[model samples]
Target: MPKPNKLLIVLAFFSIYVIWGSTYVLNKTAVAELPPFMLAAIRFLTAGVLIFIIAAVTGQNLKISRKQLINTGIAGFLFLAFGNGIVVWALKFVDSGFAALEISAQPLVILLLMWLIQGKKIKPMSLIGVFLGIIGIYLLVNQRQVLNQDDSYIGIIMIFFCMISWAYGSIFVGKADMPSNYFVNTGYQMITGGCMLVLLSLIFNEEWSSPLVWSPNVQLSMILLIIFGSIVAFTSFNYLLKMVSPEKVATNTYVNPIIALFLGWYFLDETVTLQSIIAAVILLSGVYFINTSKRKVMLNRFGLQQIQNKLRKNKVQ
Candidate 1:
């Protein structure tokens, strides 16, 4: 009912844009040495437990109804278990930057899903944005030659599905009967998702090397992924969803790929061809259009409302 704090909103945006952007590279690094599902399971479980502890210490209620748990569990399965677990697995074969670029398509997917499920009409400009996004994806994928690499293509497909799963989860959580405490809800999601990942790992017979054998770099990456990526950035994202329009909250798609590309290049020495740069431009431009179009529509509606209010006052007078 109250106005959202501009400062907090900006901070939350930064958290998702910068912190989550960095996570692509961190995830790539961790998955290089760790089993994908197991790594995700551990990272999320640890982050969830720590968040729960923090919530308890801060005097937040941990209670949840069975329905809330079920909803959050479904969200957790979609978001973390499928969305993130697949991304982690894909990072083993795909470049983090390339993966980030693909994942940027999430906004478009979310928009389409919202329109289909909620019967929200897509604006003309938003439709144009979606077209541009599809073109951009075509260009990016063509540049990558993903089909040539058997393993890499599978990874690419997995990331594509990841985007869909994440988009659906993002929209679902908005309507789901979850806890009012964002932290509490996020912790439950993480825990549920992590458990699912662990179950998947067991089903697939994923072998986990002893943590004692992990390289220092892998260890550090895992720590950062758990603390900053899952705990801090994810919580910021969920908080922003509560504070702002989902479209606005999703603008991180525009910023995250840039960060991921730069980090992947600088830290991992990943190649970024000129074609990739062009594709990035095209893709990000589409995302920009999609986000701004909605804002324009909202502003137009507000302006029209003001004009009608003025005319009504004059007639009444």
Candidate 2:
């Protein structure tokens, strides 16, 4: 590969690491003021529309086969509508930092899914990661504060399910037929996922409010989630996956939790217990073990070889 732009690389890495980490706090702030599903729906719907507008204006092909559309839609429902939407809902009960810490175990979840569902063999290093991850999760969840909070365990459980959906979606997207254009594919997933979130909001009868009526904090959080979290961060993510190595990209898994924890404690007055800190250390260490495994294949967001293949065929990387 030709030499990568060092400045662009740094900016891209910063975007994915910090911007994506901050999304947990942003979502927490917004859902406090707006109905969770509605908040997610609007954020995604707006981002999806803007992405499409950008795609069209830039002359990217928007075409897809029926099967590709179905697969992409299913992937979107798994990845965004359910994976992300449910997390937003749970944010009402869970601290944003805690949620970020929990989600950091996604690689562990993916590892087990590969063993159970796909019958893929686990590397020895990954097995150790799984062991540490389990202990970490126990420590993270078995805290007195979390147990004392009303329905917080329920929120934690729901977020666990969200991780499953996210891991499965990653595996699915790795093999499923997607739109050749990565940007266009992302646009479709956003629109489809946003539509599903809207449907969910209606089914649940969530109270909807106009953006005009939101508090300044909620409005700013919403804007940040849509513009930076969804658009800029995702674009940066795809760019980095293509420009650099997946192992380097996977560093975001651990760094995000740290940022979330600090931001939550500083801005939202969320608690960060001593035990929670220990759990984060162990859990993220586990994720590190898995990401650094010599076997370079990815079952979750851990590896992007499959994604890079798709981008190569499209030549959009």
Candidate 3:
């Protein structure tokens, strides 16, 4: 791969750190006015189509084998259609910052999932992370504000399931048959996931509002979500994985929640509670512990490609 300029590298880091964090608020603002599934469907479909066009222009082959297509489809369903789509639905009830904070425990969830599903051993630090993660989640979800709100509990619970789906998808895609090129692979998943989201929207009978009738804020939010959230951030994430060390790329996991919390509070007037602040610290610390513990074992057991894929398992969202 050609070397990216320093400016470009900085911009890529900014995209994954800042723009990715901002996605929660962007989606929250849009989902307030638009059907969640439909909104996701449109965002992904347009992004997917644009990816294919870009691929073609760049002379990248868009073709894949039958098995690869099937695997990508399954990934699409898990990671995007259900994983991200449900989170968008849940955002209607929960604060964007709160959702981002809860999801930041992703490394913890992945660790437990590996232990339970693959029979992998959990090291001592990860075990500590697990304990902290559980406590943090208890504090986060047990809030009076969260429980008092209508359906917020359900939304919070559903977001946990989404985290699981995303984690599993990450593992599966790392080992599964996938396109060699990350761009092509993501495009295929986006298209497949977008189709599934459309199907889900139809099945759920979500009202399909026309873009023409959307409020200006919603229209801008959708544009931002599709362009910056889906495309630009993803491209930056992929680029940085090649240019930087895993630790640097992984810093986004920590920074995203902070950015989201601040943006949500500043933009949408979302409340940041004391308990939630404590939970955020605990949850993010758990993530750090989990990632720190797993680094040596992962490097020894898995090849570089697998490491990259596992790290890339996280979405631009």
Pick by lDDT: which candidate is best? 1
TM-scores, each model vs. reference = 0.95, 0.87, 0.86
Highest TM-score model number: 1
Cα lDDT tens digits for candidate 1, 1-317: 34788998899999999999999999999888889999999999999999999999999999999999999899889989999998999998789999999989888998999999899998888888899899988888886455565588788888999998988888887777788878998899999999999999999899977778899999999999999999989888888877777788888999899999999999999988887888888888888889889899889999999999999999999
User: Which residue pairs show collisions in model 3?
Assistant: none
User: Predictions ranked by TM-score, top down?
Assistant: 1, 2, 3
Model 3 Cα shift for residue 3 (angstroms): 12
Error of 2 at 130 (Å): 0.7
lDDT of 3 by residue, 1-317 (tens): 55668998999888888998999999999998999999999999998899899999999999899999999899889878999999999998899999998888777777777788889889998888889989998999999988998989889999999988977776676567777776787788889999999999999999897899999999999999888988788666555655654434656768888999999999999999999999989988887887778776667777877877877886533
Q: For candidate 1, what is the TM-score?
A: 0.95
Instruction: Judge candidate 1 at residue 87 and give its lDDT.
Output: 92
The 0-to-1 C-alpha lDDT of every candidate, in the order given, reads 0.89, 0.85, 0.85
TM-score for candidate 2, residues paired by index: 0.87
Residue lDDT tens for model 2, 1-317: 33578897898889888998999999999988899999999988899899999999988878899998998799779878999999999998889999999999988877777679889788888888888999999999999999898899889999999989977776676566777666677778888999999999999999998899999999999989889988888666655655654445656778899999999999999999999999999999899888777345545544576787788889963
